[model samples]
Target: MKTLLRLSFAAIFAALVGCATPQVPVPLDQSFYTADKKTVGLMLEAPKAPGLALEGNIGLLDYAIIAAATSSLTDHIEGQDLGEFLAVAEELSQNLENEGFELVRLQVPEKAPKLAKFKDPDGKDTTYFAAKDHRTLADQYQVDYLLKLTATRAGLARPYYGFIPTDAPRAVFNVHGEMIDMSSNQLLWYSDIAHSAYATGEWDEGPSFPGLTNTYYVVMNKAKQDVLGALAKRESATGTLALNDDEEAEATESSETPAESQQ
Candidate 1:
């Protein structure tokens, strides 16, 4: 009976993951940056997925589980980055900044205690990390734009064939992420994907390893790249950026021919 149940779920899961379409970046709209604004706040949230589980996980004893339990046992563990996520907004600003907003840097004292809260109690876009006094945050740093980035929600699943693991079976990885424009309190872009063949590069067959498996890093990177690509600035004609007043004066003096003074 127990074996039947595991097989049943695995079959259903496999069917779902196998037929799913590959996901891509959302349609980007640079039009949202139409306002005269500068100074952007970075909000990179942590990823989370509460329900996904790994089957047959007992560390050194994984293969030793009783026949039934071996196929039924499951475990789950979360992944986190040291500080790699902090620079996303800043990196994205190389061209976007010139569009209008400059990302605000947070020093030790200036950093917020919680700058990555995901959602509210109701699973809605509460954005608790965005400081209650939005106006104050904006005024303090003169930040007119706040780019709130929800962490990529990563989930993992290992599908089985008839309660047995196949040769190098792929793992399913799904992520849903978005960018919010706090100035208008609306979504600027969004992308969500669930894939194994495409997300983990299991489709291509040129290079094959003896036992290469997908890890959190692989899945998370795919999701992260999607966001970066979606937000990437499109190449376009642009004028020379205006320099600050001091630099402008220095440039003016340097460009002048030393007053063509009598020598």
Candidate 2:
């Protein structure tokens, strides 16, 4: 029986490893830092309305049931004030200003469309946007680089294995930012910030899930830190610009620290 259990768990782990999403990190161009004067167009998307996302292979009936059970919790989460999270833009803008870049806010008439993703030459799906297409925005803004921050979602993520819950629901924040060179429409830097904090106590406190609510804010702050950390400049001992891959890894590790239960 133990051997059977071990094999079953191993198969599940293998399946998860096989199904993991592909990510290609592009480091920030060193030329931006070297340039005497830099102008950047900043486009930040409005944060997505909050709610619970049921992930994993859930059946139709199970999804409905989960939704029904979490309706109140969802509403409570949706009504949360995102002022703190929204302020991240200001913080990011200040960071750019400190780096000696003149920041230009690019206003969009409507929310930007979901970033178009496609498989790369290696057939792996990538988050990088289509090249040369954003030149129009750059031309209009008259900036050397475009810094786009996409706040995809802020809420809870409930992963499941069919009808069974794999773990406790987690308050989550998902955002991704990128820097593009307008001259060549090449991706210079990419940061995918995703942070989740599990509730300290029971997750299903109806009406007002205080513990989960608090955790939500904690995760949001972590996400914000990740965005800033990714943008922070780091140089190697040899005075050469370092790749952000290590910083991204460190951010992931820090964001994983478990949250203490809050009342």
Candidate 3:
């Protein structure tokens, strides 16, 4: 009975993941990032307790059982004094400062729906939360833009195919982040990125689960680095605007110099 259920679930899960279309990210618009809209409300999701995610195929009953069974283990992992999650968040805050953004740190209900997926007019798959959905947050914070880093999931990921392990378990960290224009409800930027790392040695360490724990931190750091990298690309784009301005000024001066020489 269990074997049959597992197979059924695995086949469905595999098909779902396999058939899903990839989504293209919405790029940050240069005009929206201008000095006129320097104030941005920064919202970061609160971290949740770590646990295992079963992928491939698994029945709902079995999934629930496993989740309940691993609750204690997840709790222990969460209590290990591994470290605080502040470093990357602080790094993000500092980067926004360096970019001349007036950061207004704000809090929203952690569980509030902040994103939605849909096809744009061009029929390209894209993810964005409705602009009006965040209007209250924007109005409350009195900011014209909102930048959000949604909650993260940190734990082990095991992929299975019909009662067979497809690959070794890995530590994973994932989150969805976006920047939106509150006034127009335009999604200025959005990206869904994840990082995972495998254990270097024995992973089934009993009470402490050190190997998996270490890998968890590895992916966590990588995930944060991913955010920084994406933000840097956007900042670099803003720098291009500055470069264009300089070139224009030089062009104007050169044109005037030639006119004076002709005079």
Candidate 4:
């Protein structure tokens, strides 16, 4: 009878142990870019989606189940929420335009609603969200290039423990953009940009989940600058400037000055 009771208690304990397991969030893919060399029309695709989950527990395991759980703990593990992505996209578009790229804003299908409601981190009420569908928004904007972006993991870091101190929370982002020839549907150029930053604790309070998302917009903006820099460098190397014919004519004259002088 005692053995039977012990077995039942063990089963209950095992169930509780399973419930106590920690589940770390899955990370998202970084953003990248692609384009056709001839037309220089760019197409950007966001990295694969990221999900919110507990930190450091990538493989969730309960403390009771393991004889000795790893001494390390993660500060905060969470995915980049939708609000963050929208802000990033806006910044990225502006950055591309500033860099002399004609970006077309892709719209979701007309039949579908422009904005959809989603749950925020607080889990209070539904909030509006948007996506880049390409078909609907393309007509409204006159663009030779299209840019798309996805938000991967925003904040990630190891947790602080007596045995192992936690590292700074780093922000990871993946962004891809491509330039395609509108007529030929050929790829001209593309770039895959990824970035990571250590958590300074300034964005959030004590590694809590609330403010982790705030850093996403800032990181994405930085990423835009990075992508722009890359494109600018590529443009400089290829001599396929984004300037109009008038500008090209002037550039040609400028290049002839030394030759004319030598002659």
lDDT of the candidates, in the order given? 0.44, 0.69, 0.61, 0.39
Minimal lDDT window, size 10, model 1: 203-212
Global CA lDDT computed for model 3: 0.61
lDDT by residue (201-263, candidate 4, tens digit) is 554454344444444444555565555444442243474545547646865775675321000
**Candidate 2 — number of clashing residue pairs?**
0
lDDT of 1 by residue, 171-202 (tens): 34444554445544344555664444322345
**Model 1 whole-model lDDT (C-alpha atoms):** 0.44
- How far does residue 142 in candidate 3 sit from its true spot (Å)? 1.0
User: For this target, which candidate reaches the highest TM-score against the unseen true structure?
Assistant: 2
TM-score of model number 3: 0.66
> What TM-score goes with each of the models?
0.44, 0.71, 0.66, 0.39
lDDT of 1 at 200: 38
The deviation in Å at residue 179 for candidate 4 is 2.4
Error of 3 at 202 (Å): 1.8
Query: What's the distance in Å from true for residue 83, model 2?
Result: 2.7
Output the better candidate (1/3) by TM-score: 3
Query: Residues 1-263, candidate 2, lDDT per residue (tens digit)?
Result: 23223334554676788775544676665656767767988887754466676667765566556666667876788788666667877876776787788888888557654434432344344325444366656556899988887776677777778668788888888787888877656677876777777888797877888889988888877777767666666674465434357656875686597543321
Model 1 reaches what TM-score against the true structure? 0.44
- Span of ten consecutive residues with least summed lDDT in model 3: 254-263
* Model with the higher lDDT, candidate 2 or 3: 2
The RMSD (Cα, Å) of candidate 3 is: 12.9
